[model samples]
Target chain A: MQERSEPEAARGPRRGRGRRPTAEVRADVLDAAGALLLERGMGGFTIEAVAERAGVSKTTIYKWWPSKGALALDGYFHAVESVLAFPDSDDVEADLTAQLRAFVRILTGTPAGRVIAELIGQAQTDPELSAALLERYSDPRRELAVRRMRRAQTEGQLRPDVDPEVLVDQLWGACYHRLLMPSLPLVEEFATSLVANLLRGVRA
Target chain B: MQERSEPEAARGPRRGRGRRPTAEVRADVLDAAGALLLERGMGGFTIEAVAERAGVSKTTIYKWWPSKGALALDGYFHAVESVLAFPDSDDVEADLTAQLRAFVRILTGTPAGRVIAELIGQAQTDPELSAALLERYSDPRRELAVRRMRRAQTEGQLRPDVDPEVLVDQLWGACYHRLLMPSLPLVEEFATSLVANLLRGVRA
Candidate 1:
């Protein structure tokens, strides 16, 4: 299990302060929520638990986050935001390789994989979660990669005729497939091999 | 909604001269189960309903399939079996194109997509269903495609260094991504564009 501590502000006495900054309070709540989610899955996740952990009232939590699903999405993304960032090096292949490697590492090495799988699974039934996942997480991440690919195309590193969106699908989609349907183990070298095979093509 | 009539044998009288063949009974049960699944999502699916519709005893269903998930998977596969078959034409590109097109059609045109999405979603919490899905459905389908790609490699159509498994992921994985995520519509021409972009390489 990954160890994520609640933000310092969340741990401090709530009565002594003249209302903590909104950003600090948000971070505290998310941190507490994320730690709880990582420690115990959706089954154990509750707004009451989060409020207690963060030293905030349930009303305050509810005011910002409409539902538990919404909070979970935000918390999960906040916990993983830094690690999944895309790089913009001079070389497209190198940048993609680095970014994908980071992605695979977080997915395979951390609790994020299971957390995400559960979220996606529950999203099948929960319409709000499904819409939030698309709008907040998946779509934005895809846009980042697509933007990078378009830049690569402009620089003549990637073929202009190729659709950047489909390229995004081929790369990240494969990882998600292995994650969701784990017939084959997601190997350590998968990121390298995927980038190589996709850029080079399979034609003889 | 797709109209699927119950098998004639199942619709016929149960007090026949002799016991019906196991294969025929199995077919009847699957037909009934598939129709029910397609018509109503997992929420409405029940063993009692299937047994009543198929004109078979509940004991028969339980004997063959231990859980509802197992039965649903088998029934869903049986329903979509014919359309999802991989072709072995001399041209790998044409074969992949035709097969992916069929796959996308089934996913978009029929109720199989929703059925599968629901199954996969439910599989997250259900261990037996997860195992059954991988072993019975996803793994076998991947094997079929991998086998076709290997044949293509032997014929020198696909490069020898490339991993056939990864190729499967890139193509089918992309389709699955679009189906599950739905940020972008699984467009009609996606199959063709996916194949062309992948095989030709993105490198300038």
Candidate 2:
């Protein structure tokens, strides 16, 4: 495993004092941050702008997230977490299809996808930023799918011989291919066919 | 297709006079640019620095390429093109294995890979940069693989029913997945296995 830095969740609220900030404030800040990211691109985005747009103080924002990248990361995750809920079902085929389809929807269909693309771009040069993205955005999410596949393997829905990680890669690789290279359109049918073809090899 | 501003190749040799600069001068500039990219990274990279390093004027550099991005792109292709060559043989399996293994070697084993990663990140934020990357880096290269697959199909080595584009995506997507996320080591065995398994589905 590539060495991962401790995630932001490990370093929680700096200001854990009087009247803990409400969930509404969190939502408002994230909403504003997401909007600023899309409108200004990564270059024009700033903590102060998020503060102004969200109607929250910079101190409040800093209390939650250490830096602008961290704050934007929070907003990015907010956009992602809402869309990519974990899937658990006995019917492996149905479950995998739904999960992949939902993934494609958020990645291709939403403004959130653009934020992700920008973050991915930024992460390329910045090791700390890349580590943070992997820890927060990729790991927990990938783990959920890993567990689901393991359970399916245990139940004999998938080939025991096939490595779960490779299976995951097979399912996700094409979707990301479309996302990174936008020449080809990413319709729902792509996911359906990708899953169907990969399942032929992995299914018990 | 996103409208492409003319490429550097199209705008070559503006300083065409009595003593035209030798090909060695072109090679020197690209080498310097590639070195600067490795040493200082994308943020610190600039055309002026490349000009100073290459011992050429900014006007000289601009005479060949329209922008810094274009110059860096030339250097990047220089780094990559030297490494990746097309595979053509009567034996389809041997041919693909060689092609993919060489690809993985370049992507996993060189500074060009880092350049590619940085470019991918930059491409996410800049549409023009993204288009340049797609046009210059990805499309031409991917088309080679697609053509190879289509030829294999015509030769009755691959299944006629399978879409050549999907086949290309299946092969390249996994490589990109490894590049974008580096948890798993991309050994030669991975390429060999990926091609073997993918070919199983597509083989006649």
Candidate 3:
């Protein structure tokens, strides 16, 4: 396992708390950070730049994210979490079809493609950032997908022989590769065809 | 296709140079660039670093690559072009299984993982770089794999209904994902199981 470490912090957290901070303020800060990250590549961006973009005080930004990496990390989580949720349905094929297509759409159509590419790029260079992404960000989605696949297996819709972990790697890997090399169009028909073919081996 | 505007010279050779560089010097330069890309990450290193590491002068490096990006691009092409060459054999199953296993091994066991991740990351930020890698680096492999699968289909090894492109995408995607995610151990077992399952789906 790669060693996990905290990203560089801009400053230590506030020593004491008074009503802490509002949820709205945190959301605003994260949104600002996300924009900055997308606009300026990670290497070029700074804590003060994030503060300026968000129009929030540096103290407020520091209070929330100790380092620029942490802030970018949070921004990534907030931007991606909602999109990563899996769809549940009684019909495994329908559920998977929807989920996978939705995933391809988000990753390919939106700026999310560029964002993920950047994160993966940084992950190559930064062990701490890589570990955090795998643990905090990627792990959750992988677990969720695995759970869905396992449930499908138990329900007799999927083959008992299919390994949830392997399937997860296969599905996500396919998506990541497409994101990296955007040569082919990732249309719904393509997604349906892919899911059907993958399931043939995976279904019991 | 992404616009393929990379000057041929920018990639490796400038046809009409006064004196063609020696094979030994070219290989030395490529080795140096690859090492630097892996050790310091692309952003942290410079052309001078490559020259110093290779024990070659700056003039030697510039004579070959005009910019730092060009050096990295050529090095990546050299690595992938060498690595992505699939072995030829009469038995379809044996050939693909060996090739896929070899592909996984090369990506994980060597610094190729870092190089690819870096290339993808750069592609996200730079249009020209992205186009160059896709055209020069990624597409050839995809075409080769697809051609092999299509041949399998003709030989009655693959299901007639299966899309060769999708099959190649899934196989390469799964392998690429495992390579980039450091936590996953690139075991032969996973490769074997993945191929077995994939064939199960592909076989008539």
Candidate 1: which docking quality band?
medium
Q: Tell me the tens digit of each residue's lDDT in model 1 across B154-193.
A: 9999999888888888899889888878889886588888
lDDT per residue as tens, model 2, B45-158: 799988766666788888888777777777777656655666678877788888888888877665656777788878887888878777776787778788887888888877
Write down the C-alpha DockQ for each prediction. 0.77, 0.25, 0.29
lDDT of 3 by residue, A12-124 (tens): 35212333366756776777676666555566567887665554678978886656666777786776666666677778778777888887776666666666777776676
Global local distance difference test of model 2: 0.70
DockQ of 1: 0.77
Q: Model 2, which residues run further than 4 Å from truth?
A: A1-17, A20-57, A201-204, B1-61, B201-204
- Candidate 3: residue A72 lDDT (0-100): 78
Badly placed stretches (over 4 Å) of model 1 are A1-18, B1-18
Q: Cα deviation of A139 in candidate 3 (Å)?
A: 1.0
TM-score of candidate 2 against the unseen true structure: 0.75
Pairs clashing in candidate 1? none
Q: Identify the superior model by TM-score, candidate 2 or candidate 3.
A: 2
Estimate the TM-score of every prediction: 0.90, 0.75, 0.74
